[model samples]
Target chain A: MWLLKLAWKNMWRNRNRTAITIAAVFFSVILSILTNSLQDGIFDNLIKNVVSFYNGYIQVHKQGYWDEQILDNTFEGTSALEDSILALENVNALAPRLESFALASSDTLTKGCLVIGISPEKENSITELKNKLKEGEYLNEQDFGALIAEGLAKRLKLYLHDTLVIIGQGYHGAMAVGKYPIKGILKFGSPDLNDQMLYLSLPAAQELYGAPKMLTSYVVGLENPSNLDPTAEILRDKLGNEYEAMTWEEMMPEVVQHIRTDKGSLVIIQGVLYMLIGFGIIGTLLMMMVERKYEMGMLVAIGMKKRKLMQLMLIESVFTVLSGCILGMLASIPIVFYLNRYPIKFKGELAEVYEEFGFEAIFPTSTNPEIFLTQGLFVICMALLLSLYPIVKIARLDPVAAMKK
Target chain B: MNTVIDAHQVSKTFNPTTIPILAVNNVHLHLERGEFTALVGPSGSGKTTLLNLLGGLDKPDKGSIFINGVDITKLSPNALIDFRLNNIGFVFQSFNLIPVLTARENVELIMQLQHKDRREINERVETLFREIGLEDKLDTRPAQLSGGQQQRVAVARALASKPQFVLADEPTANLDSKSATNLLDIMAKLNQEENITFIFSTHDVRVIERARRVITLVDGQIHSDTAKVSTEVPHTAQKRTP
Candidate 1:
């Protein structure tokens, strides 16, 4: 108890030095936390945007269908299968799609395009497809017309209400052909999707492809996207061997690879930041040791044990470091949350660059409690590690020589 | 008479490997209980070196020192520190009181290190402060106290743990003539009334004059050990010198 009092008093003996040390730790913590929060936030937002724009959080396909996406790999769409999937806890909604490539033509132009068949209202609920409609009316259950991507319509020189022709091979080498009025022109954030997508109502597409009651894939919406992997696993197990449920991370390895590479770079940056924090703490501790040499010699001469003196120094360091870390965390709470609420938007070329990659051009911060705890604990450990210098100095000190100094 | 300290063939060398300098060479001494003694010499004559050897602050390159019948030279470093805490007190030339602590806290520090009971520590500190005539300066830190008052507090601290003896190295060198005389008078009174042993290494004539026995060192050897008849009696009734 007496040692504690002495340590506390000693820490404040030089207020300016102590305050400078604490401020260094304080600003380091805030910078580290904000950097981590922003990195995680940007990646999370990218995943959310990619998943919601077209593919739902998880997809269920017939066995071997993802590997060979042809009309032959399509499975019969069953209401019982949909009911059983929707019964799961995290499964919010499901949309069944029949998709294949066809050659599209109008008047004097022709282009290769992807034709998708969807149940209008169910697909709208999952992907919010109606919101992307830029011209003409959206598809209905009875409508025989199709929705063409704006870029695809421009390539074919077709307009809304114009007649369009599609020709492709059907299931079992059968001939498949269709002619329909373009009911809507849809715009997509991704240029690749906008250039080649043509959407048809479920029954109309089933008839045109001569594969009635078949679906290529089932898009599963989730209540909590973070539970996507586990939910997909549960659905896969429940559906048995005939189907395979895969999360977006499994289906889109390119996106996952991008995020992983970015995270690796961030780790290196964080390492550099922690190193600077360590040096700052070490500098302060070095100054303290030099200043207190004479006093320490006197204490040792007066029969204070070296072990006790080391303990006193450690307690003083802990007081300084813990106070700085706690204050930094408290100060960062509102700033991180404010950034999360109102993200920083990019302007001009940066905004265009983000859109080019089919992503929103804003940076938000994550409010994960783990980021705060991990960063705070790591810095505290670093400061404590550097405090070993004083203990070693005291252990080897010669009282007579120190007093002379 | 109880032998409070005994030094047998004590010697210390500053740099034995290259250009060696012998600080204290083959010295022998014994201190009895309640003796007021001064180890006096010119500069670089090994008075302070011998005092450090006796106080267990440094170990001799050769020979053994016994305090209260235990040979301290044979003890381990940690054990030496514990032994010093229980049996020896120290006062430095600079009045090296811990600057962060108040005068009362400084005086209470040694007793606390000895793990004395709370009430006993308080009572002893109060008595020592009164004896040193600095009862009113209890709460003042070392920086706020005059040189005389600070040295008196150092004396009180040295006696707080009831050690077998006190070792002071040039304790009055930094004080004025009046402060040095008052400090010597207080130490002399403590020796006379409580039989507390004090051994100082100093060149000050005032301290040497008040000491009952004076041991003079020349070239790391004892030149004279004289027990003179006391002329100046310890005047406890004198007013506190500020």
Candidate 2:
């Protein structure tokens, strides 16, 4: 107890030096936490944007449908399958979709387009589809019209209430043909989806394709997206060999690869940041050891064991480093929370570039408590590792020589 | 003889592998309990080196030091430190009180290191402070105290653990004449009342004058050893055989 008191008092003997060391640790912690939080935030936001935009968190489809996305591979939509899935934990809602390709024509123009038939209200609950509407009204269950993408509308030179025609091969070599008025025009953040996409009511699409009561896939919405992988595994097991359930990560290998590549670069940057923090702490501790040489010698000469002296120094350093880390974490809480609430929105060319890549141009910070705890712990460990300098110095110190100065 | 410290044929050489300098050579000395002694010497005459050897702060290249009947030279480094803590005390030329601790804490530190009972430590510290005549300065840190007061605290610290003897290396070198005299008076009073042995290495005549016996060194060898019989000594001083 006396040694502890002495160590505490000794740390403040040079108040300016101690304060400077603490400040260095404090700022390093804040910078590290901010960097980690921002990195996690940006990646999470990208995944959320992609998932909610179209794919949902998990999907269930006929075993051979994803490999060959033709009308012949469509499965019958069963209420039992949907109920069994919804009964599982974290499964919020499921929207059954029939997807295929067709030639969309309007008077003078024609283009190859991807067509998706969806239950209007169920799809809206999962993807918030109605929020993307830029003109006219949303589709209903009995509607005979289609919703056309804004870019596709421009490509075909068509607007609301225009008669659009689609022609494609239906199940088992049946001729598929449909003519319908455009009920709404929707804008999508993804340039690829915006350029060649159209949505029709489930009944209208089934009638045109000559495949009634059929679905290509069941898009499974989740109450908690983080549980996507485990839930998908459970769904896959429940559905047996006839069907396959895949998480978004499995369905979109390109997106997962992009994230992994970006994370690799982020790791290098974070390593550099940690290196800087290590050097800062080492430098401060080196200065402290130099300045206290005489005092340490005097203590040893006065019958204090070298081990005891080292312990005193360690305790003193821990006090300083721990306080700095805790304060840095507390100070960062508001900044991280504020950034998470009001993300930084990009402007002008940057915004256009993000849209061209099918992403939002905003940057946000994550408010996860784990980020603060882990980053703070890392910095503290670095500081403690640097503190070994004093212990080694004390171990090798010659009290008679050190006392000379 | 009630000898507390015994040294024979002691020698210390600095930079043995390089330019060798013999700091203390062939020094022989014995200190009895309650004796106030001085090692007087010119610059580079090995007074401080010999004092260091006696205090177990440094090892002698040859010979051995025995304090309280234990051969300190034969002890390991860790054992030497523990031995020093339990058996010896030290006061440096610079009045090296730990600057961060209060005068009371500075004095209490040795007793704490000795693992003394809390009540005993407090009582000992209070008594030492009072004996040093700095009772009111107990709460002041070393920086806030005068040089003389700081040295008194150092002396109090030295006596707190009730060691066999105290080794002081030029304890008055940095103090003014008045402070030096005041410090000497307190040390002399302690020797008379408590029979606490004190051995100092000094170039100061004032310290030499108060010492009951004086040993002079030159060229790292003891030149003269003399004992004084004072007629003006206090009655309490008669309790010890000098």
Candidate 3:
């Protein structure tokens, strides 16, 4: 233990060298923490927007309906489907929705849109579509009321009280048309959705589309988002071939794939950055060893054993790494916390690019505390691993050659 | 008398890139317990090489080397390290005290490797530091002390281990005239009072005059062995004797 203290003191003998080495480690640690925390936060926000807006962790639809999603491919005669699924242990909320496209017209203007029919209470419960109303009330449960996207409302020159005409093909081979007063102008984040989606009462939708008793797929919710697979399986067995239980996974396959690829690439990037940091530390340690070679030889000449010399080298490395790592970790906390609270915003072209793809432009680092702990551990551990090369080199050092220099 | 160090025809060769040179050729020497022996030779006469062979830091190419009756030449590298740690102390021309360690910690370094209790190491180091008249310099690092003080710390370190022999190679080469004399006097006194054998290789006249016995080497061989008759000391009351 005393020998180790001597080794630690030896490293600090060259003050500027020790400080430079520590600074390198400290900067690397800070960069790693920032990059990782931001990556985690961005990925999480994308997932939350997709899941909370429409797909409720998992979704349930008829088999093959996921791929086709046409009105004719929905669950037709699964009368016991809802009751059977609700019996599951973790099933929280489920809402059946009918989705289709139509051309909306306001006398002089015409635009294509995705028109959706939903049970007012159930849709309200799942997506809080009711709270998304910017200008008017939610679609009335007992009466015919419709929610139109802000972009769609603009093109049609439709106000909250203005009537708009929607035309499309019904469940069968017949034309469906309807004129309804716009109850609300809803903004559902993504500009694409803001330009295309319209929500109407389920009964009004069935009457207009000529699919009276027929409906569309269900959007299911679970107690915990992580338990999506198990809940989806039970629903699949109960509904059989008449329906398929599709989780958020199938709905947002591209999003999930993006997250996986992003994580893999970030790991490689952080790994390379840390490798560079390790090399910097190794360079410093090697320099220290070279400078102290004669002194080390003298120590052994004055009765220090090779084993004790090796211990001293290791102790020096540990001290250097620990000081930097602890300082770096301490410094990261407030910076990450402040960034998490107040996100970064991009305007103009960058904003438009994200909006075009149905994403938020402003990014916030995740508030998850694991971001700090996990990154801190990774940086500290890599630094320690880098320390090994110096110790090994010292252990194999020849005291005689050391003294000659 | 018990022989503290014994070597028979010890030869050391350094394998350079293109040629192997024999540094210490066919040399044999022994130091009895409590005796001060000087192995004197000019530079490149292989005095330090022979010292290394005796200290087990380097191996003889073609001969057996023993310390306190044990054939250290046959020991493995790790065993040789343990051997040196337990049975031998070294003082170098440069003093070789660790620059980062205080005077007492420098003395305690070997005993630390021996894994002695902290209390025992402290007491022994303290005793040795006091004997060297550096009790106030116990907390001073080698770099902080003068050349003479550094040598005194080295002597204390050598004595702290209580080894059977100390191998000193030009120990006072870096000190001033007074420091060299004072250090030699302490070492001579310690050799007499403690009965610890000290073997040195030097070109210094003061060391030669103070040494009880001297062995001269040249061209990789011992050229002469002589006993000195000191003109300075009174023979009647030699309180400390080897």
Candidate 4:
């Protein structure tokens, strides 16, 4: 108790030095929290974007369909197939797709496009497609409708009720043709996906594409994406060799690979942040140690134990560092949330870079509590490490030489 | 009478070069339970070194020092600290009060070291400061106090824990003659009334006068140990003819 008083009093003995040191720790913690939070938010957004666009945690398909993606090789089952999947637990949203590649023409502008036939009533229950429409009404059951990507519509000079001519290799390499009026234009999230996608009713697309008994894939969303791998494995075992189950990670291997490769570089960034934090904390701790040197000497010379002096130094350091780190974290929570809600807008070339990478031009964030906790833990740990040196130096100080000052 | 401090042929050597420089050479000493002893010497005479060895603040090259019948030399660094906390007090030439602490708080430092309760420390601090004429200055930090007041605060700190021995290293060196006289008078009173041992390493004749016994050191060895005329009796200044 006596030593605690001394340690407390000793910390404030040199006001200028102590204050500067504490300020260094405070700013270091703040920078660390901000950088880590921003990075966490960015990474989380990347995953959410990819998941929303195509793969919803898991996808079920005929074993060879994923590799070939032909209209003939699809799992064509109704409620029974869905029941088998739903029986396994945690199947949140299931979307059945009848897919084909076709050349769409309007005013002599002909471009190859992937037309995915969907049931609008079921698609809304399965994916975010309903919410992605930017023009007119969504895919309506009453109309022989089609939802084309915004970019594809722009290229075809299309609008609602504008006829689009679709030509494709139908059943058994036979030519098939269809004329469809665009019911809606989808504001497709990924720029790449937007340029090539077209949606239609299941029955209309089956007859038009001449694949009356085929379905290309089943896209399933889960309540928790973390169960993706386990759920895929379970479905593969139950559905057997005739059908293959894939997680979102497998559905977009390129995106997964990008994240994996980025991990190495991100570690380098974390290291740089830690080093920057180290300098701030260490600089402050060094000053704190220096200011206390004389007091340490007196304590030793006057009958306080050397070890007690060391303990006093540690107590002083931990108090200052933890207080600053906790305060910084408390201040960061709302800022992260507000930023997450209204993402940072990018402009010009920067927006182009994001679009090229199939992401929104806005720098999206995830306001996860883990990000703040992890960052605060790192800063406090760093402060504790920086503080250890002074305690060690004090324990070994020579009282005679110390008192001479 | 129980001896508060007992030293046997204690030596402290510093290596200035290839040859060892003997700081305190084979000095044997004892302070009885209530004795007020002074160690007087010129500069570099190792007065502070002897005091350090007695306080367990520094290690000696040879011999053992015991305080309150415990052999401090044999104790580990940590144990030595525990020993110091419970057994000894110090008053430095510079007063050496932690500048951030109040006058009473400085006095309470030793009691805290002894693991005394806050109320006990506070009560003792209040009484000690009041006794030393610092009752009104109890809450004033060291920097706010005058030199004499700071020294008095230090004196209060030294006695606050009820330590067996108080080692003062030239405690009056920085004080004005009048302040020095007043400090010595208070210390002498404490020694007479409370039977608390006060050991001073000083060149100050005032301190020597107040001490019941004077141990004179020359070249790190004790030159003489002479009993003073009486307690509270000031030493007559004999003008040395140049």
Task: Give all candidates' CA lDDT scores.
Answer: 0.88, 0.87, 0.79, 0.79
DockQ, in order, for the candidates?
0.66, 0.69, 0.50, 0.56
lDDT by residue for model 4 over A149-252, one digit each (tens)? 99999988888779898999876676778988888888876787789898888888888878775678777867777777778888899999888888877778
**Which ten residues in a row are the worst by lDDT in model 1 chain A?**
A45-54
Per-residue lDDT of model 3, residues B146-199, tens digit only = 999999888888877788889898998889999999999899989899888999
Model 1, span B125-164: residue lDDT tens: 9999999999899999999999989999999998888899
Local accuracy of candidate 1 as per-residue lDDT tens digits, A15-39: 9989998898899999999999999
Report how far off residue A28 is in candidate 3 (Å): 0.8
lDDT of 1 at B237: 17
Candidate 2: the clashing residue pairs are none
Top of the candidates by DockQ: 2
Model 4's CAPRI class is medium
How would you order the candidates by DockQ, starting with the best?
2, 1, 4, 3
Q: Kindly report which residue stretches of model 3 are placed more than 4 angstroms away from their true locations once superposed.
A: A76-80, A128-131, A260-268, A299-308, B229-242
Could you give candidate 3's per-residue lDDT for residues A1-405 as a string of tens digits?
676678677777888999998888788877888888889888877776666776677777767877887788755434476777777888877787777888888889988988888878888777878777899888766558689989888877889988889899888667989998888889766576778888888778877787875667777767777787888888777778867778787788888887899899999999898888878888997788788888776666555667777777777877887777778878877887888888787799999998877787867787677776777677677767776776676677666777773
| A1-405 per-residue lDDT for model 2 (tens digits) | 988898889889889878887888788889888988998898888877776678888889999888888999889999998999899999989999988999999998999998889999999999889988999999998789999999999999999999999999887789999998999999886667788889999989999899899999999999988887889989988999899898889888888988899889989998988888788778878888888898788888888899999899899989889888999999999989999999888999989898788778888998999999999998888878888988999999989989996
C-alpha-based local distance difference test score of model 2: 0.87
Fnat for every candidate? 0.71, 0.71, 0.46, 0.59
> Which candidate comes out best when scored by lDDT?
1
Indicate whether candidate 2 or candidate 4 has the larger lDDT.
Answer: 2
* Candidate 3 C-alpha error for residue A222, in Å: 3.5
